[model samples]
Structures are given as C-alpha cells and as structure tokens.
Target: MKAKVFIMIMLFVLFLVGCDSEEEVDRKVQDHIMETYGFEVDITYRESLNEGNMGDRIYQVQRKDDPKVEFTVDLMGMWETKIAGDNYEIQEEAFFIGEKFVKKYENELSKLKISNVVFRKSSGLYIETSYNSTISNFKEETLQPLMEFINLLNSYKESEKFEDNYAELDINYSNDKSVQLTQIHEIKTLGQLKEQLYQDLDISNESLKAKDEELFIELENDLRKLGYQYEYGLNSDDPRFESFGCFQEFYENGECNEGYRMYLKGDSLEKDKIFELIQFLNSHSSLIFQDVIISNSKDERIIFEDIKLIKSMADIDTVYSGVNESLGKTILN
Candidate 1:
C-alpha cells in the first residue's frame, strides 16, 4: 500500500510537469533571473524582426512588484537556457533609469541606436547607460572612454544636461550642446590639420590663426549660400575661441591627431549636399588637409568614413582620408 501511494504521487507530479510545455520555459526563465540576478521576476517575451537576429526570443524581465526594474535577456536556441551576452549591453546602458529620461531623449538617443532605456525601477532616483570611428589607430576597443563621453553629451537635453550624475570628466569637449564642435576642440589657427601635425613643415607665411579666421569668414558665407553651417567650434565671435590658435597640436602625433573636426551642416542640408561640401573642401584647400569629416550635424554621424586609403580629394569618390601622423595621409573607402 505504501509503494502504491508513492508511485501515484510520482505519476501526478510527472503529469503536471508534462502539461503546458510553454509554461515550463517561462518558469525556467524566471528561475534563471532569480538565481542569476536575484530578482523575483515575471517576463514578457518579444519577437525581433531585425535582419541579423530575426525571430530573436527576447525576454524582458521585470521585478515581480516593481515594473521599472527591468532588463533583457536574449534566449538563444529556443528555451535552452542560453544567453547571448550577460555583461556588455547592460553595462553600456547603465545610465538609462526611468521613463521620463527615456521619453524626453528618445529622438536624440535613437541616433546613438539607443531606442529605449529601463532601469531598476525604484521609488527613488537611479540611472543606467560606439565610437565606430577609425582614426589614429583608434579601434572601437581603444576608444571606449571617449565614446562614453560622446554618449553622455548626446543623451541629455539642453536644460537637463547635468542632471545625470557622472564623475568629474577630464574631457575637453563642451558641455553646451548648442556650442559648435569647432569652437570647443581647441583654440588657435588651423586651416588644415597637417600644418599642426607637422609643425616643422610650416608653410604659413602669416599667422595660421589669422588665415583660419579669414578662411572661415569666406567659408561661412559660402556655406550659408549652400545651406550649410559650421556645427562645431567655428563660432568666431564666441569669447571661448578668442585664445584658440589654429596651429596648435592638441593630441599626440600619429596616434590621435584629430585635424580640424570642422563638421559643416545645416537645417536644410541634404545627403547629396554633404558630399558636395566635402568635395568642395577636398579640392578647394591649399594646404594638406586630410580627415575632413562631412557629417549630419543633427545625427552626429560620419556621413563619410575613413578607410585608411591614399587618395586625393579629386579622386575621392566614396571614401574619406586622414593623415596617419607617422604615415602621412590615408583615405577611407
């Protein structure tokens, strides 16, 4: 009689387990989060329609009572308890805390490919949060810190700029998003990056600063005529740039010489116009100018990228170029 009762109980347990296989996967996910993240949670699964990861089984897990405390775990191999990554995505998204911050900055954040942010939901305050650039041997790996700085700048609105708490920054980039990048990068005269990169190769008969001032004045009028505006650091009247000399070397040679990051864009600028202006800068320059970044000011993306080729502006059809400091000039293709 005892054996029979034990057998019946075992059979009943098996029957319960066998019923509803989908619910079993849910339990496993919930258990995985609880064991792994120490959060007693429920999950909402989403199907991704993205090209590379089509039909991605994305698990959006929320703390049982608190909805704000949420994160995503990608289940690979169809309920095999496999995860794509545990560290990278969350650490990168560390500053995105709640709905208000996310909603306010959605349009701006989307440019960074950050469409949504949800943090450990709390009654109190908390937050969480790629340089695809390839200049100065700066692979995505070496420039993580710089990328973080750029991310912080673009993630905030004008009024809420300092609301996100970060440690004291050593970056030279401007806090004011409205400020043009040209004005803030450095002060001094820079007609082209090569003049400063190889200071010994000075071809200037006049003060490079004076030349820069003259050149920009002429360029500004022409830019406006072409519906373009200097997006970074070229505000001639701003007092911050009063001391800026165009001929100074701010970065180490060859490793990271950002020669004249003068991004020209306008509210009415179209994609074709970016190429036109870049080509204009390319062929028009008297000095050895490389790494002329033609970008969408609003998006802050390199419309043209550098591929380490060696081509002149006249031959530049698709790629961009930058001086290697050690190797002189290389192009992007």
Candidate 2:
C-alpha cells in the first residue's frame, strides 16, 4: 500500500509539470507571432467640443508593418488647400526705388498678380510667375544661366548678387526637352521684363493678354477634370470658392483660417458638404500638424497661432455611416 501511494504522488507531480511547460511554450509562441506581424498604433481621442478632454491609447494590430501608417479621424470638414504662386528673389536695395518701390511698381505695371512668392530651389533666387503664354514654358537657353547661378549658391551657402548680365536667361538644351527659360530671373524687375517682353509681347493673340483670367480658367478646368466640384464665388465667404483653390475663409469668430473643401456634384457646400468635411476633420485631427509640416517644409512652419485643439466627440460610427449614405462613397477602391 505504501509503495502504491508514493507512485501516485510522483504521477501527480509529473502532470503538473507537464501542464506548466505547455503553458510556457504557448505564451512564447503567441509573443513571437505578435512581434512578427503586429503594428503599434497610437490613437488619440477627443472628448468634447470645448471641454478639450483628450486621451491617447496604444494598440497592437495583427498585421500592419509600415512604420509611417497614419489613421485620421476627421471631425471638421477641412480638406487640403492647394497653393500656387512664385517666390521673389530681388534685393531690397537693388531696385531703383527700393523693395517697396519695386513691389508697388510690379503691382501697378505688371498684369499678372505678383504676391509674396519665393522660388529658391537650392539656388540664389528664382521666381515662378504665371506667364501669359502656356506652352510648358521652360527652355535650355533661358534656364541654364539661372541654374548655374543656383548651383553656385548651393555650393557657397551664400547669397551673392549676380552681374546685371548674370540675370539673363540663357536656356540651352542638348537633347529634345522643353525647358522653361523665360520665367527665371535673378531680380523681380528682370523677371518682369522677361515676362512682359518675351512672354507676353510674343503672344500674337491679343485676347490671351490677360494671364490672371487664363490661369483662373485653367484652374477651373483642371479641378473639374479631376472630378472636383467647382463654382465661382460671388459672396466672399462662400465655401464653394474653397473648392476652386481659394484658401481664405472668414469665420464668425472674426478670425481667418486657411483650408479648402471639395464635394461631389449636386452636393451643397453647406449641408451635406459641411457634415462630410466635419467627419474628415475629426478623423484627421492629428494629421493637421503633419500636413502643415509636409506642405511648407521649405518655408516657415504653419502656426495655427491662435487656433486651439478643442475636444469633441460624436458617435464616430454614426458620422461615418451618415457620410457613406450621403456621399455615395468615394472612388478610392
């Protein structure tokens, strides 16, 4: 009887040991699988419109490996804004009447709108102004000299005034390629000269003299071709203008914000569009900062200087469902 009892105790100890070993093996396998195919996601949730209570949670997904994957929960109807323009590269003192005088002169003398544009691409100073003619405007003779200047600037890490002759566009193409030569200039005045004399004066059609109008039309057609809704804005605050690449929108708070929105055809910018935009905003709240960074990586950072990240939450599932039902779904698939 004593020998049988001892044997039974030994058997019980073996069973427990086997069970523990199995558990350990299972845990390790699970951990390895999780490490292999899993993704670490940081999700931030906002609690209220004004209460501003927000929280972030880290989640492990089974199959995402891209380190740069971003998921946005857009709440407000904010879409990306398309900005097009040129950069100014002239000296404040180089102009006969100084920088202010040059600017005023350009605004008064020139037909195309010359706002504060800077087009320095590893070069001294080149501007991208919308020419009166649209023939994919670069050539070898016109751009070569400017590119050489730009190369010099990159190498020196300094800004030096090229000779008045240095500002000339000497485009030369060894191969068959369209190079925009006329649009580049070392100074605003020189660029204006190139645009007016070679670019504008060369155009035979008198009707095409108006570049700003032509550009607006081109923008309209391009947006339409891209399947975006388009319309002219009579009222300054109309959101429809946003769809046409206008970023200025005034709010009730007496502050100005820059953003754009586009909608499907037959959709109202105020009703269905607003809700859709709101959903996009909510989903992409975190992306706002990143978008700014990417869009203006070469310039000054976009400071939402006065804007506050207020908290807000509606039922996300409900908002998403409503968007799908109303928008009829996007063509991303």
Candidate 3:
C-alpha cells in the first residue's frame, strides 16, 4: 500500500511538471514571436518532431493583427525560437481585399462559391472549381499575369500596384489534376477583368453541364446497344440521396455528392437485360457516386444492388472502391 501510494504521487508530480513545462514553452514561443515580428500572436497548434537540434517543438503561429497570415516557427535550444517559414507569404491584405471584392460581386459568382476561393495575395486566386473547355481558355486568360485582375481588386485603395501574378485552378475530378496559371506580365490593362472571370466561369459551367448531358446520352445509347432497356438517374425523397458530379452542389471534399440508380424499363425484368445491366453496373464503379442503387422497375422492394464509394479528393489511395456482391459489403482488395 505504501509503494502504490508513492508511485501514484510520483506520477501526479510528473504530470504537474509536464504541464508546467508546456506552459513555459508556450510562453517562450509567444514572447519570441511578439518580440521578433512586433505583433501579438496565437499559437494555433504545436507539433513535437522526432528530430531537432535545440527542440523538436514546432508551432503554427497566427497573427492577431492579420487573421489570414500564418507561418511555422521552430523552437531551438532552451526557449529560443524563430520563424522558419515565409510569414509574409500571404500578405498585401489579400484575404481582406479578396473577401471584400468577392462580396461585391456575389451574384456574379454562380458556380464559384465563396468557400471554394482561396485568395492568396501576389499569388492570384486559387479556386476549387470543376473542369471544362473554358478551363483551357481560363488558363490562357488567367495565365497572362493576374496583375490586371489584382489591380481591379486593389483599385479600391487607389493603388496601381500589380500584385497577383499567378492563378491556380483546382479541379475536383476523379483524375485529380490542378491547373496552375503562370504568365509574363502584360502591359495592357483589362478594366473588364472581373467580367471576363464571370464570363469564363459561366462558359465553364455550361460546358460541364453539356458534357454531363452528352455522357448521359452516350450511356443511354450504350445501354440500348447492349440490349438493356433501362432507366438511369432516379430520384428519391431520402435526404441522403444526392446525384454526384454536380459542380453547383459539391461536397466540402469537392466530390459530386449524388446518388445514382438504374432500373429496368418495364415492371418485369428481362433476364438478358438484367444480366447485361448488372455486369455494366459492377464495372461502372466511379468516385462520383457516393451511394448508388440498382433496382427493378417495380419499386425499392426490388433493390438488386447497393453501392457505396469511399473516397476523398485530398487522398484517393486511402479509399476502398468496388461493387460488393453476395456480399454484405464484402471487403476485398
């Protein structure tokens, strides 16, 4: 009983010491940032790395003055620390101006939701929108230096500085490709640069819709050719049901959060059509459909197959995607 009490007391003392040490580290970091940058800060988060000379502690610092500005700092030695990242990487009031500017033209941005926008000053706007033909043109237009557009956003301050020189378009597709635009500074100024942006976005949205429609038509034709009279893209009253591949209605992860279904054309399922359709559906696994249903013409009473695609735009390899059969979601490689 004496030994147990001693051990518990030692553990409690160690815990208090650990807590005190953490408090000291936090104070040291906070003081170092304030002293160096002349700005108050909040330690957003800290990480303890395995290998470091003075200390393994790393901190993500957020400026009290500029909420958008963030940088990494490494603690070195016993209480010494310095900024290890470009603290001014996102400056020029980019977040302030970008948010303000975008708000002015809220109605213009039909597809480009505010959340999908990342306005990095001097680096142009990074938008996580879908891909289409206009993306190519957007590449051309935006690549010619974002100075023209940045000037428009900055004009409110009556400053004629060309800040934005690059543009990045993140496409949330299964392929997962990013279209970055970098270009030489052009001398000409486009007063209608904002208009051009909206114009390109509109075209892109239209083109994407047309592409989906074309694909739908093609799928129909292909199914008919396979001798399967079927109905594709059914709707449901379930709140969880979502038809995937819609840029207008994308999830936070940038996936088409839509449900899909294909049914036999008539109440009675033809064995040949069912066979062809089942084979096709199994092979038609894609990242777009989060949940899919394959049913007969009768009703939900005859759900032939149910599919769930697990994936995220940030990392695709971490997900398991396949058609489960006989298989109460048979987990197979």
Candidate 4:
C-alpha cells in the first residue's frame, strides 16, 4: 500500500513539473526578447494533449503597449517567429513619414533612413534603422535631443508611468540610397510631450515659411528679369502641388499629366507681349511651363492656346545671339 501511494505522488509531481516546464519555456523566450530588444512584453503559453501525449507548446508574445503587434513562437517546431496584426503596416507608414521629414531638411540633417522605434524600461528608448548596401551618416549635431521626442498619446497602448522615459534614434541607409529610420522616445509626461511636439511642429512650420519666402524672392527676381510685372502667390495648401514635378519630361512628354495654374496680377496684357514671354521661356528650355493663365491688372486673361505652336514660332537666331556673341569674344581672345 505504501508503494502504491509513493507511485501516485511521483506521478503528481511529474505532472506539475511538466506544466511548469511549458510555462518556463514561454517565460524564458519572453525574457530573452525583452533583454535583447529592450521591450517589455506580455507572454502566455498553452499546451495541448493529443493521444494522451503533450502536443506542441505555443507561446504568444505582445509588446506591452502594442497589443496589435503580436508574435507566436512554437517550442515544439523550429521556433520560428510569426508576427500578426497591422503593426508592420503601421510601422511602414511611420517610416515613410520619417523619410519625408529627413529628406525635407536633408542638407541640414544626416543622410539616414529610420526604420522603427522601441521603448524600454531598462534601456530607456531605442531606434531601429536599416540600410540596403551601406551605413548612414548620422550625427548628434543634426538631430538634437529635442528632435527625438515622440508623443505616445495616439499610440496603441497607454501607460500611466510615461515620464520615466528616454529616447533612441536609429538611422539606416544604403550605398544605393535606400534608407529606413525610426525614433523611440520615452514619455516623461503626456502634457509635456504634447507641448514639446506642438512646439517642434511650430518651429518647423516657421522655418519652412522662411524658406518659402526666400524661394519666392528668387522667383520674383527671375520673373522681373524676364520683363514680367506681376504679384505672385504660392498655393502650398493645394493637394496637386504636393506631387508637382516641374521637369521637362513632365510638361512635354506626358510623363506627369498634372497641370498647375499660376494666378498673376500683371501689367502686361498685350498678345505680342504674351507671345514674347512664351518664346523667351521656350528659348530657355522651359518646356514644362504649360497650362498657365496670366491675368493682368485690367482683368485681361492670356492663355497659351497651343504651347507647341508658340515654341515653334520663337526665333532661333535671336535666342542664340548671346551664346554666339560669347563664342565670338572667346575666339577673338
């Protein structure tokens, strides 16, 4: 009878150990990922019994704040990582925004691509970036600590202790010019983050406005040199302007079919003057300058009914006179 009881106790202990072993696998995997990537994760494990034997053990892992970004690891099989949800898609979109932001001020910023950001309790924050063929040229001088601030108000998960956060920036680029960039920032306080985000946006807006003003001045000078008296305005809010490409192929070859209408309050209203303006532009190889309507001070509208016809009518001899004169002077010297 004692032998029978001891056998039963041994079986019970074995059952408990089996259950704990399964749970231990899940915990160890989660802990490994947390330590490797510095992300806090929630993990759950389940085991199935088939034919009176334990089946595959499944582990589900999720980032603390990003439940949608979940992964499943099977300990019985090859232990392959499987991802679910739209986390990759969301991260891709954020990467595109980061790419544009970097390109907008590339001359001032480093040439790097940002991939994604990871926030951690132990290591603070980290950014992940990848390059295709080579590394990026990122520097601390360009990306100030203020630029690393990321607002988590609209994030997948909300945290009460957000202020105990730091940030990491990742920049990736390739020799082929492909880049991905991401920024991970710790949340110190919701209000503080919101305020800092708004402040940064405001500063960026002001800087862009200043750059636009400078470009407008340059454009005005060019137009004035071409004998055009006009008041010009920029339609930056127009969606079409967002993808506008003022290249020769876009205007002449139908590669880019979009058109832009420039509204102007000008002094010139004569047909001859309009023709001269068109001819001059053509001589300067402004082939993409089409679909433009010039309105004068008297509300007179001038349109280039046939851009090709106007281009053909421009005098080649007159257009090349300056070039020929320069060549002649060079020859004489």
**Candidate achieving the largest TM-score:** 3
Using TM-score as the yardstick, the better of models 1 and 2 is: 1
Candidate 1 lDDT trough over 10 residues, lowest sum: 176-185
Q: On a 0 to 1 TM-score scale, where does candidate 2 land against the true structure?
A: 0.18
Clashes of each: 29, 40, 7, 10
Which residue runs of candidate 4 sit more than 4 Å off their true CA positions?
Answer: 1-111, 115-219, 225-264, 285-288, 311-333
Give, for candidate 3, the lowest lDDT window spanning 10 residues: 311-320
Per-candidate Cα lDDT values, in order, are: 0.43, 0.30, 0.44, 0.40
| Superposed model 2: Cα runs more than 4 Å off | 1-146, 149-243, 246-258, 261-273, 281-333
Find the 10 residues in a row with the least total lDDT in model 4: 324-333
lDDT of 1 by residue, 47-153 (tens): 54233653356677655764445566666552233555333234324434346566765666555443334333222223333122221221333234344334444
Candidate 3, residues 201-285: lDDT per residue as tens digits? 3334333334455555556566666654434342223324422223334322222345333343434344344444445644654
Per-residue accuracy of model 4 over 147-218 as CA lDDT, tens digit each: 332332213223433332334444343332322222234444443433333223222332333434454455
* Evaluation by lDDT, superior candidate among 2 and 4: 4
Can you give the lDDT of residue 296 in candidate 3? 41
Please write out the lDDT profile of model 2 over residues 42-133, one tens digit for every residue.
33332222213121211221223432222222222112111121111233223221233234345432433222322322233333223222
